[model samples]
Target: MHDDGHGPGPARRQDQGAARHEHGHSHHRAHSPSHEGARAAGRLRHRLAHLLTPHSHESADRLDPALEASARGLRALWVSLAVLGATAAVQAVVVVLSGSVALLGDTVHNTADALTAVPLGIAFLLGRRAANRRFTYGYGRAEDLAGLAIVLTIGASAAFAGWTAFERLLSPRPVEHVPAVAVAALVGFAGNEWVARYRIRVGRSIGSAALVADGLHARTDGFTSLAVLAGAGGSALGWQAADPVVGLAITAAIALMLRDAAREVLRRVMDAVDPALVDRAERALSAVEGVHGVGELRLRWIGHRLRAEVAVVVDGEATVRQAHAIAVDAEHALLHAVPRLTAALVHADPAPVAGQADPHLALAHHARV
Candidate 1:
């Protein structure tokens, strides 16, 4: 409920004073940093500036936010894919040496993962291209398409794995060189865990949701690797059917993840904003002083960031300059509250209206031309 620009900490009092002055009159007053509250706000801004300095260049590119997101996503995908390829080659060798059906299935899955890297990498690089007349939104959605393809590839791999496991389960076979299978699985587990950790860290730092999703995918594989290891170990202990059962379990897990990813990618492609995020944005906007209310709050996801457009109702008695300043303050406050917000359009309303008040209707009425 607090309407302070610097957040709801001790800075509320100073912010309230500034808001009162800004809303009451057109007089400009220099902000004095003496208030503990003002100093706290200054510090927060400084820290945020430092954290976002690297992204500044990307933000300035004039390229669509989605495109920038794709570039970062592809870079992460390429690196993870390379690691997967190397792991798959090693896994294939182990499969051949141990003659383990489970190991072979894992090798195939890894190869499938590596194959997805090709399209994902291409999509990232191509998605960043400047928008042509034919594609005004640029190729940002290419990344979402690429993500959908990756999910499909994973689903297919999982299905194949399940089929292979079912066959192995029906007709059990003796696995050769159980020790070798175990060793290979252990190596794979360690390698995948490392890759997953690195990818997750980098993905978060870059604010690339696709990369974060991919990292989660890699981490799931790591868990699968552990499952494979357990099966191979069990097979060594006279439980020959354990390997196939574990494979089926892994396949099921992958299928579930694929389903979730598919839903997320579809939503992204359709530009759906998270309902929770929309609600949070509404709260932030409504909290700004001089804003009697908020309406027509529309939010869209552009890659990892959000684009928002809202109407802010101010007192009808306020001057045009006062209303514009209130709108500007609301813009700043909303962006500060929502870091992922790339841009916002704040339409100022003369008074609060209820029951289907169209902000755009107000705009049409106020046009000078």
Candidate 2:
């Protein structure tokens, strides 16, 4: 009895073997071509990564040049202040001998500028120190504070000088030793110009806001010295009133500079990154091939460099591993584009599609609904 229910026949066995062979062939045909292509692409990517990875470290090392430039600017400030202090003392004696209120007030302003330099030098030194627990962002802001202090001091000096000049304008006074004052003003102008050039070069090279502020102050002083020379020349020619008039002009110029300095310091303290800079950052992130969109871009100034955080959307069809790799590549591209970026945090989001129920799109609809 061929248990009519189930019995293996030669024909049935041959049919099963043919079915197994067809199934295996279909599986090989489905995966083989794509697998080879993927493998080849991966090998190319590995070679590229090896070549590009070292460049990131090299770019990081370039930051040292900026730090060194800042250091040089600080040293220049100290030296310039020392020389100005000595000149102030000499001018004080000359002003006292001449009994010229304009000369005396200018000398006083120089002395105040000299005093500001002392604290600024200290702040620069401290700012360069390694970060401690007390200051997670480091002492870099000390330089900003020093800049504010210097501007305030200069502003106050300018106000006082203006007041003194006004009094002299109301009642003109005879000035003696006009030749000596003129000579001194010329020397001071030359000295200030020298320091201003040095500070500007270093500040721009390092992107140090404090150094730039100091350089501006020096340049203002150089212009004031020119005003002083004109006053001395007028006094020698018996135009005693020119001393106060030139003093008033110098005070006006100083006030303008103080306004600008205050604006810059406040911007830094408030972490206000320029809109242009933000746009640049967005462009840099979007340049990455796999990044579909960018959002929640935020940036803040950390001393000379910028700290940024952004959200990037990538192809939703990609595997989890691919999304992660794309995110890393986007980050690398951003750093390369903006060399001054100190740190960046990137969030990877899945891209949205027309018919699919994307979580991000759903959340947006819910908010609108």
Candidate 3:
């Protein structure tokens, strides 16, 4: 589980060979040349496709190297902050020149987006702390808390945008210097799109839900900027109410973004993972030599890293040492098969015989608790 790379190493192969020999299972069917070739090809295809696809928070696997995920997350926040800050500055200048209320609100929105990086950056720093007796899991949950903050920020942005648009609708204002406003809107869109793509890519690579949510927020801001640009065009044609109407539409869009962001963060908080990952883990466990069946498998994310707890059924007559070897082999298979899986705890259970008592009943009370 602590290996530096994904594939099985020399030590792992040795252990697997020993376990397979002890179990007396033939390697012919499972380890044929064609089967190994297919598996390798499948892994390569997955890696290539993973680079382009933006997986959901539940579905994405962490790709950063050991102890480097937090560093990457922090880098993404700083870069996003810088880009968004400059974008807001340019929009602010246009706000003053045009006296356009809609443009001014967008500038403020962009500024707020830039400031969001502060909480996420702090969370990334906190995630790097080593575990102690008091916090056995370390401060990884801080990243989840940061994700909540980002969700709240998105909610606030939606509310503010809606209110501004409502007020403007009540008292429509003439937007002056339409040309300047249009140019600023384009600048805002370009800056936000770039930041969005960067943050999302890094976030997926590191499996940081907070970072991805922040990226989605930036995308919403980009759409808002485009809405402003559209309004500016309408104003140039002497339509005074166009800005507020477009602002209202942007607010609706923000609401949708808020929903998706909230769902991802809440799922993370709830320890929800994609069922496909669970199936993959089960298959890995079942393939381990001497494992009769996979009893139970559980995977959860702790701050961008994955940990597993599993139970595997082995021969009822096997001694403790043989069972332990089987468990070790199962753990090794899991680490190789599942991406971002840093640790696994495997429990070996004896397979039931026809008339034997249930071994699991010894822990029935614990399960109820």
Better of 1 and 3 by lDDT: 3
Better of 1 and 3 by TM-score: 3
lDDT tens digits, residue span 246-343, model 3: 88888888889889989999999999988988999998888776789997788998888888988889876665555666676788778878887776
Cα RMSD (angstroms) for every candidate in the order listed:
9.3, 15.6, 8.3
Model 2 alpha-carbon miss at residue 228, Å: 1.0
* TM-score of structure candidate 1: 0.72
TM-score of 3: 0.82
Model 1: lDDT equals 0.69
TM-score of each: 0.72, 0.77, 0.82
Clashing pairs in 1: none
Question: What range of 10 consecutive residues in model 1 has the weakest lDDT sum?
Answer: 1-10
Each candidate structure's count of clashing pairs? 0, 0, 0
Leading candidate by TM-score: 3
168-276, model 2: which lDDT tens digit per residue? 8999987888888887677667766777787777766766676677778777777888888889889988997988888888888788878877787778778887798
TM-score for candidate 2, residues paired by index = 0.77
Clashes (candidate 3): 0
